[model samples]
Structures are given as structure tokens and as C-alpha cells.
Target: MTISLKYRIALVVFVLQVAIFSPLLWFTFTAYRDADLQQLQTREDVFMRLVSQLGRKALLTAEPTDFQLFIAPFSKDSHINRIILLNQSGIVVASTAPVDLGGPLPVQKNERNTVWKTSEIANATEQLGAITVHFSRAELDKKVEALVKRGIPIAVAGIILSALVGLGLGSLLTRRLKALEQATRRMGAGDMEVTVAISGNDEVAHLAQVFNEMSGSLRSQFDELQQVQQELSFQAQHDPLTGLPNRLLFDLRCSQAIATARQHKQLLALLFFDLDHFKNINDSYGHQVGDAVLRCVAARLTMALKDHNLIARLGGDEFCVLIEQLEQEQEAAAVAESVLHMLTVPLECEQHEFFLSASIGICLYPRDGDDEVRLLRNADTAMYRAKAAGRGGYRFYSHEQTSSVQERTSLEQRLRKAIERGELRLNYQPQVCLTTGNLVGVEALARWSSPEFGLVAPEKFIPIAEESGQILAMGEWILDDACRQMQKWRRDGSTIPRVAVNLSALQIQRSDIATLVRRTLDSTGLPANCLELEITEGYILQDADRAVAVLQQLRDLGVSIAIDDFGTGFSSLSYLHRLPIDRLKIDKSFVQEIGSTSRAAQVAQAVVSLGKTLGLSIIGEGVEQLHHANALREWGCHEGQGFLYAPALAPDQLHLLAPFKRLP
Candidate 1:
């Protein structure tokens, strides 16, 4: 299907040369032979004229012998095969051939012959009888044949020369083309150093030079592409935020380590770590500062572990470490403590220093797991146990911890299906006006009534929901349900003035929370003024600026906002005025010890004084017993709720309490 470039060029040249010479050979042969024949004819005509002049004298005398002598020399010419002289009487007066001397004038019949007829004048006075002469063309024909024979060799030489020249040109062209072809093949085969040589300033040479430049350009681009691919590969395996091995790379290396440890019958320790209360850092500071702290932690980890271990950021503030060839399990604990001490030195970002702590879980090879997944999982479970054991510590993976995690996992699974199965309900807790001792509003609390667990506590599943990212949906449902219930209560001629719903940190951080709240208010036909949304102090301060912005949007809708569990976290009192909050609910911990000479009671009294000073309403939460109520009222708390008056009850059971305000 494909022809060689060399042969193709040769064939093309040969055909062109033949085409040019074929026409040239024909034209030269025809024109040259014809011109030579014409020249011979002219010579014969001159000789015939000379014969006519001399024969005229003899013609006038009417003497045959004189005419014969005059014309005899004419016949002696080489081109003259025969010559004849004629008189006016049409008889042959003289002839080069003696046989026709007394015969009538011979006819000039041969078409190839040169014949001339003329009449002569005697003494230029009287015209002599016409004297006709004829000359033969055989000699001119022979000369033309000689010329044709001579031109044959010349034409053959010309055709051969044309072919040779075409072949030479084609060879030169193909040589340059072949060089480029070879270079192209070499470059295609990944040889970046190959280049074509430019031989001249012609178009072909210019093309070759451009090709060489393109080769260099392609090589440069190829090298750059390779470098980019390498960077991308590295990025895929390592965390972009901290430049540490990412989860995927960690898993791969962990697997290899497990295999190697098994083969050498060596002990391997995997340390799973989670930054303690990391969300609080993101809350008080920002994610930027949180990321900086994580980077600093990674740097510290790398410095402490050196090249003997594999360290990885397993996403967020969680990192993993694989320490191989551990002589004993205690070595891992020592390493964990060393790393934890290094991390506790306090990381600084944006002129803010953070003292951080990490809960580390260690799982040893052959004791905890024989593989990567089991080892990583077991270590993570133990790390959570360490976190539960009050973080800033390390724990070894054990069978007991694994069972605990299994139970938690089962609980998480059941909780996920709880919402869809309608296993959740809202319980209303009355908020009493402390001065009036009358009900002002009610707080809606979410309670799960799962058939499998039978009244599981919110404290247990709330953390699971938060960690598993289910809190957002749950928060939305709670908001919508609370608003709807408040609307129903108003329609039922109940005197409830307002309904408060708890919003999780995840809910407040969502951009759509305002839209969702507005939609709930509109659909439930609940006035925004009668709906109070409560968020905790620490949660709101996570991204304080954005939280303030979102809270402002809710406030714009005429909704009341409150800070729940006040004094438990940053207190964040400096920005309390900046936040569009209307109330502060004293945390139960403080209210539990109220009226006692305890620090909690003092903090509770201070919170109430602070709320009043800031022109905000105060509500003491979990207020039980008569003394607690007297203490909250003395502190100028405007509202209080607890088991002292009544506990969280169902809607039907709420009517058992005395109606107040607008109860119909």
C-alpha cells in the first residue's frame, strides 16, 4: 500500500523526462529535415537558371550541338541526376543523358525532383524560343537522409541527458526528504535529541529548520508535561495543606509495612491520633488558623519521628503514624508521648498561640490486627476511647474497646433510620417568667423513641449525628417541626407566646439555613417573632463573622436569637453585643449549684448580671428546687425552666400545667 520515497521520486523524474523529450524529439526531427530539404531545392533552382541562360543562345541559333555543350556542365553537378534542354518546338534540343538528345522534351514527373523552366533572350533585343531545363532531386534527398541519420544520435544523447538530470535532481530531493523522515521516526520513538540539518536557504531547507525548532519545542513541552504529571502524582498521594502523606498513600505504605512485619516476625505499631477538641480551635480561631496549626503539628511530627516512621494526615486534624520494628509495645507509647509533648508546645498563627493536645491510640501487629484495615480501624477505635478517657492521653487497642466501637456503630446505623421510620418526637418544656412566676414560652426538645433502643438519650446520639454529618438534616427537621407545632398551638387557642428550637453548629454554618428557616416559617404560618432559635456560644464562635452574618439574616426576619449553655465555652462575652442575640440561657451546670457557696452559683449570678447589664433577657436552664429559683430571681434572671416546676412533657400533657397569658 505504501511506496518507498526514493523509488517514487525516481519514477516521477523518469516519467517527466520522457514526457518532455518525446515532444522535443518529434519537433526537432520534423523541422530540421524539412529545412534541409528546402535548402537543397534552392541550390538546384540556381543551377537550373544558369543552364537556361547558356542554352538560350543555342536556342536562338536553333543548333542542337551548341545547346548540348552549354547544358553538359550542368549535368556534371552532383545533385543533378539528369539535365535536359527544350526548344520552342517542344523537342529536346540538348540532354545530359545522350539517349534523350533527339527526343521530345521529357516530362518533369518526379515529385521529389527539382525542375526549372525559363525562356532566354538573344542580345536583349528579341526573345529567344523558350528553353526549359529540369534537374533531378536524388542528391538532395540523399543529403536529407544523411542529416536525419546524424540527428538520431544527437536526439538520443539529449533524451539520455534529460533523464540523467531529472534522476540527479530527484536523488538530491529524496536525500533531503529521507533525512527529515529519519529524524521524524527517531523523534516519534522518543529520541528528543534528534534534529535535521538545514542545507540551504531554499523553502525545503527553511522547512527543515522549522522542523528542527519544532522538535526542540516539543522536547521542552514533553519535559514540562512529565514534570507536571509527577507533581500531580505527588499531590494525589500527599496532603496539599500540610505536604504530608494523604490517606491513600498512608494506606499503601501501611499495607506494605504490615506485610514486611509479618514476614520478618517483627512487631509493628500504628499510632492513630486525633487533635483533641479540634473544632473548638476552628470555632475560636478560623479554619485558616486551624490549618496553620495542623501544618505546624505535621512539621513537629516529622521532626520528632525523623525518617524511621511513616507519618500521614488522614484528613482534618487526624493523623496516623507507622513505627516499624518496634522491640516492645511500650516503645510506641514512648513515641506517642514524645510526639504529643512536641505538639503541646503551642502553635502560633496570626499572632495567636494555641496550646494543642492529641489523643493517640496504638495497635501492635499480630496482637491487634494482621492487616492494614483492621489495624487502622482498631487504632482509630482506641483513639476515640482515649478521647473519651479525657483526651491528652494514649490507649492501646484492646478487644473490649473494639466491642464498644461495635456497639456505637450499631447505634449509629439505627439512628440513621430512626428519622425515616418516624421514631423521633418533640417534648415541650415550659419556660416560666421568674418575676411573674407564669409560663412565657416553651422549648422544643428532640427525643428519639426507637423501638430497638427504647428512649435513647440525646447526649448519646447527638455526637454520633454530629460526627456522621446527620445533624444538619436533623436540625432542619427540628426547626420545621417546632414552627409547625407553635402554629398548631396558636390555632388551638393555647397561650404559648413563643417556641424555641435548638440549632446545631453544623446547621448554623450552612449557607441555606436562613432559606430553610424562612421556608419553615412561611409554610407553618408561624410569625418569625414567636419563633426563637437558640445556638450555643462555642458553636457560634467557630466562624464568628459568618455566624454573625447568618444570625443577622435571621434577625432581619424578626426572629429572636438566644445563646444556650452560656458560660460553658469561650463565654465570647466581648462579641456578645455584636451578635444579634436577645437572651442568654444559663447552663445547667451553673444552675445545679445555684444558692450554694460554689463557683458555679457565682458564675450563674454573674451571667444573670452580665445579661441585664447588656440589656438582654436572662433565662436560667435546669432550675430545680425552690432555693435555685429564689437564687435565679435574686440575680434578676427574667426566665427559668427545670424539673422544679415541670419536666419535658408531651403536648397533651402540657395542658396539665396552669394556663397563663392568652390561654383560651
Candidate 2:
């Protein structure tokens, strides 16, 4: 609805031209009419003066013929349609149009006539008659009409000429303004790059220049902010070091992958991998080398997986792989195997060769577990199982494995609330002298009585605690409670030697184990020698040097280390010497078949002999039958604990589990 500047400028010029010329044309007509009237009056005056002189003689002594002669010129000159002359007697003497020759000029003015009158007197002041001259205005009217007729066309033509000239100038000036207007419109529509081509030095041109400058500045600023936003967005989801998706992004991708596989009715796998011996590598070389190895591993994984799978680094040498659209569940094993093969290629960093291998555990959708957390946890548990078997391979989760994983998850959830719910308690199983059946010590066992599940076995939930990293807290709690119970028994005057508490590999791995032990003894007011620490051979020999250092550090505090479930692990005999092991408890499987000529019974006999040769105390677990205890005593086993003597009893029922020889 806007009027363009081109037409507006033309309209202004046209209006100005009309305003100036109208007044000039009107004044021209008025001036011409006034000059013509003045000339006519002068001519009439001169003729009248001449006629009055001639008429004086006629009036005084001559006849009407002389008056007629003077008046005849007036009629022929066309200055008058009628002329009149009057004598001193106040009567008309002559006239140009001779109607009455002396009619006294009719005594009135006429609409069509121009009249002039003058007085005639003698030289000495004598009174004389007045003479009046009459002339017709028809000729003056004709000239005024002619001038008006001629000037009208000229005025109109001048107006039109001014309009064309104005249009030409306006178009030339407004062209740049139109360009600026277009540019402004584009900028309003979010086009910051829009600019005008300014050519002139007028105000419009200057305005266009400023607009271009502003557009450039806005474009520059917009680009900078856009780049910054992109960088921030990328950094939020990516690992800056490996440039891989972090845990948060991995979870998102996992959810998406699950949804996609579900929609397509296909199977997918989630693989969780942890580098074997990574910590040892970090300790051997330096952190820089470790970082280099991690980066190299990431590169190798990326190359191996390509676009067929989603790979992410889940922090600290742990990585996850998501394989989608799997036609067969076995495809997951192939992907995992390829990853293992890729990682096995030794990495040479800083002129030193570093060997890398990973343990990968796979959980397939609709088979192992469903949700992201369940899938991730299942894969991690399977990974730990793979580590238990042997490193440097892949494992596809089985149904039993999945059930175990679920049980672990459920147990962990319940165990976290166990202390608050008062479901966890220590049951002391008495250890007796194998020969005389006298009590030597007691091993504290943890029992969970869940309101929902009833009595759950320790074997089921203990491994769950170890895998979930809750064992550290559970171990500390057990030690504190066991030490306190031992002190209580002492106050009640019991002769029990020591109270033994079991430790997991996770507990042994901590540098704070000594501190935890010391704090527990100090808080419970129990002597360090009365609180025994038990660990599995498999766990202790995993990192022989670290375990030795840790166990010796505890032994230096007056606490003893007993190897539990001996003859079951692939423990090197040298580890026994390295470790300050004070005792060895024969594995229960070996003691069950003690009387039989079974390999298990022979292994138990060998273990008892090994403990004797090493000058360490030996005990037997799972001693159920009289012959089992007799066989252990014959094998030189110093002590035993199992159902044959008594089941684990509560603190107040220690008298029920009182040490006595087995009834025959």
C-alpha cells in the first residue's frame, strides 16, 4: 500500500509548476487589460482636446460642419462607437454618431462606453463650458478576449512541460532509494548479507552505506556465535581426549539402538570391554604412555568397528560397543573377536613395546536382558567372568549367566538396604582341633534373612557384592562387627582364640586395607591377633607382589593371613613363600571325598603335607562325617569346621556350638 518515491517526487514537482504558473498567467491577463485601457484613455484624451479646440470656434462663430469634421475621426478610428461634445450652455454641440448632434451625451454613463470629460476656460480666468468625450469599449473588450484566448494554451503546455521534466529528474534520483529499500526488506527477512550498491553522495546514498556496514557486522557476529555454539554442543557429548562418545552419549545411543532393533524385530548386542593389565601398564611405564596406548586402542577400535557398530569410551580404558541389525546372535561374537584381534596387535609407544588385550562380554537383546542398564550390567558381569576364565577372549552371555546377572542385580539392590533393614548378621562357625575336637577359632559368616526372599545363601549374594564393588563396605562392616563380637566374648570369659573374617580380591586391592583393619581393632577394643584375615588363593595370587605387600603390611600389625579354599586355585607354590601366609584351609570339595581314594582326597592330603612342610597351620572345611575328621587328623590337618561338629550359631547360642568330640 506504499507509494513509491519515484511517483511522489513527480507529484511534488507537478504541483509546484502549476502553483507558480497559474499566478503568472492571471497577472499577465490583468496587466494586458490594464495597459490597453490606459492607452485607450490617452487616445481619447488627445482626440477630445483637439476636438474641443475646433469645436470652440464652432460653438462661438462657426457651424456644426466643423464639429462634424472632428467627430468623424473618432468614428472612423474605431476608438469609439459614440463620441459627444458639450458647449458652455450645457448642451451637446457635436457627436460622432449623429443621432441628435447635441444631445448632452445622454447625461449618463453606459455599460459598453468609455467616457472622459474635461473643462474649457479662456486665458484670463473667464468661465467656459465643459467638454465631455465618449468612446465605445467594444474594441478594448475584443483585445482582452484575444489575449485571454492566446494565453490559456500556453499556460497548459508549460504545466505539462514542467511535469515531464520533473518526472525525468525524480526517476533518476529515486533509483538508488529503491535499491536501498529492497536491501532493507531483505535484512528484515533475516538476510544479513544483503547490501546496496551506492553510487551517489546524497543522503540516500549515505544511508545505504551505513546499512551495508551494519549488515557486514551482523553477519560476522552471527558466524562467530554459531561456531562457538557448535563447539560447546560437540564437547558436551564427546570425550575430548579420545574424541569418542562419552558415557552419557553412549547411553543415548544404546536406547536408540534398542528401539531400532525392537522395531525391526532383529537382535543387537552390547559388548563391554576392559583392558587387561592396564593398571600394571600404567605403573610400569608412565601415564603419558598409558594415555598414548588408550588413544591407539581407540583408533584401532574405530577402524575395526567402522560404521557397522557404535563404539564409545566409557572412561579409563573401558569401552562399549553396540552392534545393530544382527541377523544372528553369533554376529556379536564375531564383532567382539575382531575387536580383540585388533587390540592384540602390540602398540609401540615412546620406543617401548606395549602389549594390550581386552576381555569382552556380550549381551544380546531379547536374550540376555532388555533395558540399557540391565544390558550394560549383564555385559560387565560376563566380562568379569571372562577375566575369571582367562583374559584375551569374548563371551556371549548364556541363560544361566543372565539369571546370575539378574540375581546379582536383585541382591545388590536388597543388600544396599540390608543394614538398614537389619537383615544381615554374622554366624560363627566353630573351628575345632582335628585330633581332640577342641575349639581353636571361629570363622564369622554373613547371613541374609530377607523378608521377601527368606534365607538366602551367602554364596549367591557374596559374589554379587564383590562384583558390584559393595564388598569393600560389606568387608569393613563384617570386620568391625566380628571384632566387636570377639571382644564381647572375651568380656564374658570365653576361651576362643581368634575370630576370622573373609576378604575379597577387591578388598585386598585397596591400599587402605591396613588402615581399615587398624581402625576396626581400635574401635572395637579387640587385640589385632584375635582378628584373623582370610583370603582366597585365586584372589591373593592374582597380583602376587601387591598381595604380598598388602598381606605383610597387615601381618606386621599382628593380624594373621589364612589361605581359604586351598588346592582349588592355580596358585603357584612360590606365592605361599612370598606371602606371609600363616595357615591354609583345605577346600571343601577335597574334604567331602576324604575317605574315598579320590583325587580330591589326595589333593587334600597333599595340601596338609604342604602346609606342614611350609611350617604353617592347616585346617579343614566341610568336615561333615566322623570319618572325614578322622581322615583329616590322620593327614595332619590341625583343625576343621563343618556340619559334623556343629552348624554356625548366633552369638548368644555359642554354648550350643560348644567344642566337644563328635558323638559316635
Candidate 3:
């Protein structure tokens, strides 16, 4: 039932040989027997013709001896079986067989012998008798047997040769087929690299070639799929903008670090921070610049920390760091400081230089919170506190700060609605010419009177506005309101020479302040010269070159620029001279400590000298005492503004007061 190809092929060949040679051998044997029988028949005919001629004499003589002599020769040749001579009376006169010499001619014929009868043997006048001859069939059988013996060996050899050829051809095909099968099996077992060797141009070879091509294509596709999977996994866990680990990945690593810390009873700290006023950068310059800034920040943060520290972008401007196996909590502070310092460097994007700062909050393991959730929450709380405390610093988590942070959050929400609720207004304080004791200009200040929390001070709310991005809108409101009030005062015949408006660092850095000033002046129909814009000394020093350009633009619009809170920041004198400023306002703290502290007086004197030398006027704020005013005047200070002159007052009240009057 089940047969190998070799055996099957051999059997088929054997069957074909037998079918072909069997017929051929039988035909050869049959032809040989026929030829031999034809010769035997020819000899019998000749013998009968001869006997007819020769037997006449014997029949005439009526001698048995004569008949015997004529037929004896043929009988001895082994072909003639018998010969008989009969006379006219139908009796056997002569016979080759002696027993038949006296008897009548035999009527029975032998089956194995061929009988031939001759015409009558007669004399000249009448017929005498007939002669009969018999030929043997055994010689034909002998010739056929000889032919079969010669043909059998050749046929057997031919059959054997055909079987060998069939087996060899079968082996050639099966070997290649077996190799392809093995290669296919290997491919099925996940070895896609396997290939079959092709030998000939036959179908099996073609099949092997196709298999090799398929294996290579499959391997290529599998490699591409694996690469795509790896890329997708990386994209899933990383920030697309910064290439830093995303929030999900950060949380996972933080949780793992916490576990390790817990098991080892080691200290770890979680630090959270975000860039201050980063939104302003995005709002002012476009997201392209914002994204570039974020990338730079991520790179700087990575460079700032140790290799073991894990840093991640929690999204947008926020980032977190996990510091494990810390020796002390103070180490976290050092790391935070390094990070802040690294951020302080100028970031250049699309030809615009930016000076950035961050407020960082750190929380230690077990001391602040046990788990990542609590730790991150507390760190975020501390960061908000750092932002509220004027930003550009770091704070450790404390239980006391949480309530205040919550309150700040509530206040920020209320402040967002403050402008719509009409809870905001402006007050103007009088600025006097110290030499003439006459009112010159009034400084405009923002005041918020909330229905829920009445009369919040500028000190409490301004920083909140700046940090929460509310300052941009508030700054616009203040500029418009101040210009409107100044115009109103002018309409009332109040000769307030100029109105000074304070500019937050956010307003200057995040927006085109010069353009806003021009728009406000045009809208209010006020002269640009009647407005003085005050910026803190520290903010100007952040990017002195950009600050100088912006101040120059404002000055070109005919508005006066003042450095508020002067001598407080680390300002380079080289940059001080480059500033397009009209006045330097001594910080209120220094002004208040003028008589109490010699160092404060000396700093105030130095500022006055610097301002005068730069051809700019000096204004001393918080000149509460008479001696403070006298001391500032003696130092060549041009103007003063404080409670001594007047607290910031309502526009109507200020209009009621004489514009040129000296306060008591």
C-alpha cells in the first residue's frame, strides 16, 4: 500500500520491461518455429515429388525390395516418418516400414506427423499406384526452444538496466524535495532565515527558489514590525516635545524608588518645580519658541542633576525629580539650588533671549509623606508657596504652609473674577519736588476691595497676579485706568505734570510693553510725556540687553522710564549707564532706614550720586520722617513720594487737593 518512490519507480520500470520484452520474445520464438516448420514442409514436398518419379519403377516391378531402397534414404534423414507404395488393386505392395510391406495401406494417420500423398506411379499406358510420405514436427520445437534461450538473458539485462535508471531519477527528485521539506520545517519552527538550495530548472527547484524568497521577505517584515513596536513603546513613555519621561513613566519610577527606599530604610526626596511666568513666554512668542524653551530646560535640568537622579516632565512647564539614598534632606536643597541656577542662564530661541527662573518645592520621605501621591502633593504645595513668596527660590514642605497655600488658591480664583465684579480701582499718590516743596507728579497704584475679603493690599495681591498670569490683564487695566484718571484730572484743571505707573516684570518680559503704553495713551487721548513707566531694578538686570531695547522703544514714544527699587539688585554700572531711564527711585526699605542705619543712608547716597552722574533724576520712596526728606534733599535727590506727602488717594480727592500744594 505504502511504497517508497525508488521502489515504486523500479516496479513501474520492471512492469514496462516485462510488458515490452515478453511480447517481443514470444514473437521471436514464434517466428523461428514458423520458419523451421516452413523448411520442414518444403522438404516434405520435394520428397513427395521425387518419390512420384522414382516410385513408378518400383510399382511396375512389384518388388518390396525396390520400394524399400527408395524410401529408406528419406526415412534415414529423420524428417520422413514413413513411406508406402500401393498397386492398382489398392493393396500395399511396397513400404518403408517393413511391417506395412505386405499389408494394405494404413487408413489411420499419426497426429505428430505431416502426411504427403503423390499422384499415381504409372507406366506409359496405365497408372499403377500412389506413394505417401510423412514428415516429423519435433525439429520445429527444438529451433523455438533455442531462440527462447538466447532472448531471455538480454531481456533480463534490459529490465535490470531500466529499473536502475528509474531508481536513479527518483533519487534525484526526492533528495531535493526532502531538502525543501526540511527547510520549510525549520521556517515553521520560527527560523525564518532558513532557505533551500536549488539545483535544477525543474518544478522542485522552482519551488525551492520561491521558498527562499518568501523566507527573506518574511524576515524583513518581522524586523520592521519589531522596530515599529519599539518606537511605539518609546513614544508612549516619553514626552514628544522634550524627549523626557512623561508623567506616567515618572510615576512608575517614583513608586519603584519609594519602594526601594522603604525596604532599605533610606531617605529620599521628591522635588517639584515649574518655570515662573512660562505662560507669558508662550503667549508672547508663539508655541514654537515655547517648545524650544521647554527642550532647553529639560536638557539643562538633566545636566544639573546627578546621573542617579530621575527627572521627568510632568507636562507643560512642570517637572519632578526623585532623589534616592540621600544622606540628608539638605542634599535635596542643594540639588534644587543647582537646578534653579542652571535655569537662570539665558535661553535663546529664534533670536530672542530669555531669562528664566523656577520655584522648587521639596519633600522628604516619611518626614513629609509616606507615599508618592502624598509626597508629590506636598511638594507641589511647597512649590506654590515658593511662587507666592516671590518665586525664583525653593521651599521645603511644612505643615503650616498647606493652609496658606490653600488660601492663596482660593484668593487666586477670586482674583480671576475680580475685574468683572468691579472690585478693582486705582489710587494716586502725590510726588513732590524736594527743592521747591511743590507737587509735580502722582504715582498710580492698583487697589482691590473684595466683597468677601475686603481691601487686600498691593503687596498681598500683586505677586499672586503676576504668578497666576492675571497680571497681564491687570496691567492693561491699570494703564488704561491711570491714563483715564490723569486725563480726567487734566480736564478738572489739575496740573499733575505726569502720572507714574508701576510695571510688573511679567508685563515687561511677557508682552510688548511699549506698544501697550502707546495704545493706552492714544485711547485715553493723553500725551506720552505725561506718563512715567516704573520697572524694578532686578527685572531690568535679568536681560539687560533686551531691557535696554524695550526701554529705548518706550523712550522713543516720549514716555519717561524709571528704575524702581534701585540699588536692590546686582546691577552692573556699565549696564546702568546704557539704560534709557529718566529717574531712579530709591527702594522704600532703604529710604525708611535712612536715619536708623548708616549703611542704609550710605546706600541711598550712593544711588543718588549714581543717578545724578547718569543725568537722571532721583526719587526717594517711603520718606516718612522730616529728617529723611531733608537728608535726601541734601544729597541732591530731585523728588520724593511717601506717606509724608500722602498715601495713594482717590482721584477725586487728589483733584480736590491743590496740584502745586506742599503737604504738611
| lDDT (0 to 1) per candidate | 0.83, 0.81, 0.84
lDDT score of model 2? 0.81
Candidate achieving higher TM-score, 2 or 3: 3
Error of 3 at 225 (Å): 7.1
* Global Cα lDDT for candidate 1: 0.83
- Tens-place lDDT per residue, model 3, 1-664, is 8998767766776677678877887787777778887787787777777877677777666665766776776667666677877778777776777788667878756575455555677778987888776666666666666777777787778677767776776776688887888898898898878988787888988898889899999999988988999999889989999988888888888889889999999999999999987876776566898999999898888877747568899988999999999999888998998988897788887787888999999999989998889999999999988887778999999999888888888889999999988999999899998888788899999999998889999999888898778999999999999999888878888878999999988888777888899999999999999999998887776667778898999999999999999988868788988899999999988888888746988999999998888899999999888888898999999999888878899887875456436633
Q: What pairs collide in candidate 3?
A: none
Q: Candidate 1 or 3, higher lDDT? A: 3
Best by TM-score: 3
In order of lDDT, best first, we have 3, 1, 2
Better of 2 and 3 by lDDT: 3
Model 2, 1-664: lDDT tens per residue?
9877787898898888888888988998899899999998887778777766776667666375766776677677655565565666666677776784656556555565565466473335544455566567888889988997898788879888879867977887887877888888888898878889886788988898898889899889878888999988788888887898988888999998888888888888899999986764564445787888888888888888897668899999899998888889778888888988887787877776766788989898978888899899889888876875678888877767766666656778999888778899999999998776678899999999998778999977786677567777888888889999999999999999999999877776654889889988888899988988998887654556777878888999999899999988768777787789799999999999987878988899999999999999999999999899888888788999999887888988888864374531
- Better model by TM-score: candidate 1 vs candidate 3: 3
Residue ranges of candidate 3 with Cα displaced over 4 Å: 1-171, 174-243, 246-248, 255-268, 275-304, 314-317, 324-331, 337-357, 364-378, 398-410, 435-437, 509-512, 597-601, 625-627, 655-664
Candidate 1 displacement at residue 315 in angstroms: 3.4
The C-alpha RMSD in Å for every predicted model, in order, reads 10.7, 6.8, 6.4
Collision count of model 1: 1
359: Cα error in model 2, Å = 7.0
Please, what is the TM-score per model?
Answer: 0.62, 0.70, 0.72
